[model samples]
Target: MADHEEDDLRMALRMSLQHSPPEAKRSKPRENAGVPTVSASPEESPEVKRRELMAAAAEKRMLMSKSVAASKPEKSADVAVAENSVLIVKDENRVLGGTVSEKPEAVCKEEEMKDVNFGEELPAADANQLFSMIFGNGVSRDILAQWSNQGIRFSSDPETAMGLVQHEGGPCGVLATLQAFVLKYLLFFPDELGKFTPNMPSQNLGSRRLSESECVTSGDFASLTEDGKASALVRSMVEILFLCGSKKRAVIATFSVLCQGAEEQSEDGQKDEIFAKTLEGLPIESASDLQKVLRVNTCTSQMSAFQQLKEMLPVFQSRLGAMLFLISALLSRGLEFVQADRDDPSPPLVTAPFGHASQEIVNLLLCGKAVPNVFDGRMDLGGGMFLKGIPTSVEVGFLTLLEYHNLCKVGQHLKCPKWPIWVVGSESHYTVLFAFDTSVQDENELEQWESQIRKSFDGQDQSGGGGFISVEGLHQVLRETGINLPPEKLDHLCSTGFIVWSEFWQILLELDKSLGGMKDSTGLMGKKQFDLFHFNGIAKSVLNGSQAISGVESPLQRPRLSILRVSVPPRWTPEEFMADIVVPPGPGGNDPSGKDTVVEVTKPEPSQHAPLVDCIRTRWPRSICNWVGDPPSIV
Candidate 1:
C-alpha cells in the first residue's frame, strides 16, 4: 500500500497485461503515475532499503493477481483458473521472491482458497527432496501429505481430516501402540520391508512431486477395516522409508547389518542374506517337516514341535512382510514385550512366535487353540496364504516370486535405492522377502508369576464353586493388595459388578502370548484366525493328536472359562508392568540373565503381603475373625 509499492504494482500490472490476448488487453491504467514521489536516498540504511524492496514485491504480487484476472475475464466462472493462476510473475528478475517487510496476502488468500476443500485440486507446493525419492513415480508430495493427514490432523492446520487429540492414550488407543511398535522395532529394521514401497516416477517437478493417480490421494485407505488399514499404512510407510535410502542414509548406517558378501554391503544386506540361505535350503525342504514345525503340542512332557525342529534344523532367519496388523494386535494391550517377574528386574528377550505369545488373541481370532510349544517357537515366517477359507503355509520358492524389474542389477551391488527395482535374471522383479525372527519366545518367569497371582487372590473351593467375584470384592482385594488397575481397563473387564476369575487368568495367558503388550483381558473379541501364530483351528487338531493334554480344549470349541487348567496366570498388576519401561542388557548382552532388559515391577514382600484377613475385613467389618476354621498363622 506504500506509494512506491503502488507505483511498482501499477507498472508490473501493465507489463503482465501486455501478454494477454488482444481482446483481454484493453485495460486502462487506473492511477496516474506521472507524479514523481520522494524516493529513499542511496545513503539510507540497508534495512530500510530492503523493506522497500519487500513492499514492492508485495505490490507486484497483487498486480500479478489483477493482471491475471483481467486476462481471464471470459472464463469468469472460475476466477482462480487460467492466466492469473499460473504461478509466473512478469519480469521474474525484477520480482522480489521474499517480501519480509510485508506478509504476502495474495499467496495467503490463494492457499486459503486451495484449502477450502480436499476435493479441490491442490496447487503443487515445494518439493520435499526426501519424499520425492521415497515415493518414486507412484506417490507424490500431495499424496504423502494426504496420507499423513489421514493419520493425524492438527487444529491449527487446515482441516482436511479429523483434528488430532493428543492425550495420555493418544487420539486413538491403537495409534499409541502403533507408534511404540514403529519407534521400537520397525524403524530399526527396514532392510526387507522397504522393497514393497512405491518409488518416484520422475526426477523433477514444482515444489512437491505429485502422483498422477487420484487413488493416491483418495481417503479410501481410511475406509478399510481397522486391521486392514493398519497393515496398508505400515507397508506404505516402510516402502517410503526404503525409497528414502538416499535421504535417510544416516539412519540407515545405524540399522544396517553387516553382510558376509562384500559386494552386498548395505542395510538391506541382512535380509538378502537370509533370503539366500532360505532359498538355498528350500530345494531340500520336506513338506511334512514344515507342517510338523507349526504344531504346538507335539507330545506330552515334550517342548513344542517348533522347539524340537529348531533343535534339529538350523534355525534360519527369514525376512517376512511387515505384519503391522498382527503387531498392532499384540501391542493393543500395552507396550510390554516380555513376561518377566516385576519384583525381579531384568532385560527380557523375545523367544519364538515373536509377537503372537497371547492365547486370548488366538482365541479371539477364532484360532481356537495353539500347539503345545508353538508359542515357544518362532512364528510361521512364510505361512503361505489362506486357501479357500482355510490357512495354508506357502510352498512357493523365491525365484518364482521375483518381478525382475532391475535385471541388470542381478548379482551386482546396489549403491543407493532407486526405483526399488531388483534384477533377478533376464527380468526385473520385486523382492518377495518374508519377515522372520528367531528371538520370539515365551518368558521364563511367565508361569511362575501366574502361579503367584492365583495363589494370592483365588478363593479356593475345591468342590468346583464357580470362580465368581464381585467388582466390589475385586476392588477391596486390589486395595488390600496395594494394586491399582486403570479405571478404563477396569470398566472394560467388569460389567455389572461380577467377573469370572478364569477370564482374568486368560489375560495373563495373553501377556505371554502378546510378548508383553497385554497385562489383562483387553481388546479381546471374536476375530478371524491368524495362522502365522498357528491360532487357526489347526492347533486344535494338533492338540487332539497329543495324548490329550488334560483340560486343553479343541480350538473348535468355544472359549470355556468355567474350566480351570492346572496352569493359570494371575491378575498381573499394572504397577509391575510400568516398572519395566526400559531394561538394560545383561553383562555382554547375552542370555546370561536369560531375561529381557525391563524394569522390575516391585512386588510386596511377605512382610508387606495383604493378609487374607484384611481383604475380608472390608465387607465383613462386624463378622468374627474365625470362619468356621482358619490357618494357625492367619497373618
Candidate 2:
C-alpha cells in the first residue's frame, strides 16, 4: 500500500510541475542570460500583476499540500495520529516559506542528550605572533634585534602574560604593561626623565596645558644611545613585561622584588629597615600565599596596607620609592584586578597590532585592569571585584600612539588630563609629553556649536538627509530661517554644489564671531547664573525704562513695586514648558513693532540659547517673557 501511495504522489507532483506557470517554474541560468524575462504585460497595473503572482504562488502551495496529503498510506490509529501532527507542523512551516527538513523537538532533545566534551583546551598562542600583535610592524627591526642581543625573549604564552584577554581591544595588555612601567619610571627618576615633566609648575598647575618644550616626541627615544639610562630603563621594562604574563605572576613578581630589595637594604642598615621588618615572613611565591600572610581580602585591609606603604615612602629617599609606589597601587586594587573579560570561543591568536586602545586599557591605567567600559568606574564584575573609573583630573595617564596619528578617539579622562601630562607611546618606544597652557586641553565650543548646527540642517533637509542637502535646498532653508548669506559666501560653502554638514560647520566657524570665542563658562557662573542673569536684566529694564504700567499715566508717577516674582506650577517640567508654552500672534498675525517675534511655533528646533531657556524654566519657572520660533534667525 505504501509503494502504491508513493507512485501516486510522484505522478501528482510531475503533473503539477508540468502545468505550473512559466514564472513559477524553476530553471537553471544560461551563459548568455541577458534576456529580460517578462513578468507581466506592460498594460497591466502593478496591483493586478501583484495579485496574479500571489495567486500563482498560492496555487503551487495548494497543489503540493494536496499531493502530500494524498501520499499518506494506511496506518494504525496511534501511528496515523502522530504522522498527522508532524504533517500539520510541516504544512505550517511550508506556508511560512521556511525550511521543511528542520529537526523536530524530539530529535533536538536526543541530540542534546549525547555526550559532549566541555573540557577541551584551546591551542597555546605563538610567542612571536603575540609580540607582533602588541608592538605592530611599525617598530624598527633594529629594536627587536637589540632586545634579542640583551637576552630579552618573548613569552611562550603571551595570552597568559596578558592576563584576561579582551576580544575587541587588541594588545591592551602590552599597553597596560607599558603604562605601569612609565608610571614607575616617573616616580623613580622624575628629574632624570628628560622626555616628560613629573609635575607641572605651580603657576600652571590647574590649567591642564602642555607646552611645546615640555612635549616628548619619538625623536627623544630614537635619539637614545645604546647604553644610556633611558635605554636601560626601556630594556628593564620590556624584561619585566615578558616575565609577568598573568595577574598572579605580576603580583608575585612585584612583592618578590620589593622583598628582595628590602632584605638587601636591611643588612646595610638603610632607611628601609622598617619596611623590611614589615615584610619579615610574608610569602612572595603566589597571590594566594601573599594574600593569606597579609590578610588583604577586604577593602579596609587593603586600605590599611596601602596607608602603611604610603607612610614608608618618606623613608625611601632612593629608587625604592618607585617600587613601594607600584606595590601600593597593586595592593589597593588587589591581585585579580587586572584581568579583563574574555570572549566566548577565544581566538587562537591576536593578529591586530597595538593601535587604538580599548576602554579596558584606559581603565587599567586610570584605575586598574582593562574594565569593560569608560563610565565613572562603578561597575561590579561579580566576585567582589568592582572596577573604578579614571578620575576627572588625573596626575598621570597614558596617551596612545594612534591619537597622535589621528587614527583613534581618546576618552575625555586621558584627553583633558589634570596635569596635562601623558605617557605617550610610539611604535617601539615610550616617552613623556606635557603642556604648560590649557589651550591644548580646552574643549572647542565652536566645534560643538557646529555639531548643533549640523543637526538643524539634518532636521530641515528635504532633498537628502544625514546632514546633507542640495545647494538649492540649503539656500531655501537659510532664507526661510532669516539668514541672508552673500553669494560669494554661499558659493564657497557649496563649492561642490552640495551642502556637507562638516564643511558647512567649518565655514560657519570661520564666519561666525559669537561662536568663535565661546568657552565653557559654566565654572565661572554657578548653576543658576543664567536664570539669575535673565531675572536681573528684566528687573533693571523695568526699573530704568521710560515705559509705564498699564493703569499708570507716567513712568515715575506711581511708587514702583519693591519685589518682582515669577512663578510656574510645580507640575510643569522644562520639557513640558517648552512643548506647552504658546505666544499669541501679535495684533493681526504680524509684528508691526518690527522686533523679532514668533507668529506660531511650527517645530521645536534646537537653539543655541536652549540651555539658557531651559535653565530659566527649571530654576525660575514662568520667568521667560518671550519665545523664539523654530529655525531661529541669525539677526
Q: What C-alpha lDDT does candidate 1 achieve relative to the native structure?
A: 0.26
Tell me the whole-model lDDT of each prediction, alpha carbons only. Answer: 0.26, 0.34
Off by over 4 Å in 1: 1-96, 101-104, 108-635
| Pairs of residues at least 3 apart in sequence or in different chains that clash in candidate 2 | 161-245, 209-435, 209-436, 209-437, 210-434, 210-435, 210-436, 211-435, 211-436, 377-389
lDDT of 1 by residue, 293-396 (tens): 22111111111211222221111112111111222222222123111111111221111122111222221111111111112112344566221110211111
Superposed on all Cα atoms, the candidates' RMSDs to the truth, in angstroms, are 28.9, 32.1
- Scored against the true structure, residue 535 in model 1 reaches a CA lDDT of 7
> Which portions of model 2 show Cα errors greater than 4 Å?
1-307, 314-331, 340-363, 371-396, 402-413, 416-419, 427-429, 436-439, 444-449, 462-464, 469-484, 487-635
Worst window of 10 by summed lDDT in candidate 1: 530-539
By lDDT, the best candidate is: 2
lDDT of 2 by residue, 1-635 (tens): 34432333433333233223223212222334243344345334554344344444434544554565689653432232232112112111121111122122111111121221111111123223333322334454433222211111111221122111112222333333443344333333334444422122212434432233433231122222322333224422322322222222222112221222232113334534544453444332322333222211112232232333232332222222222223333333432433333221122212233334334433444434434443343557899966454434443445544443455434556545544345444343332333333343433344444445555577667654566788777876575544555568787877887787666654553343333321222211111111111101001112223334345444222111111122232221224433433343466765676654543353234433433333223223343323323211110
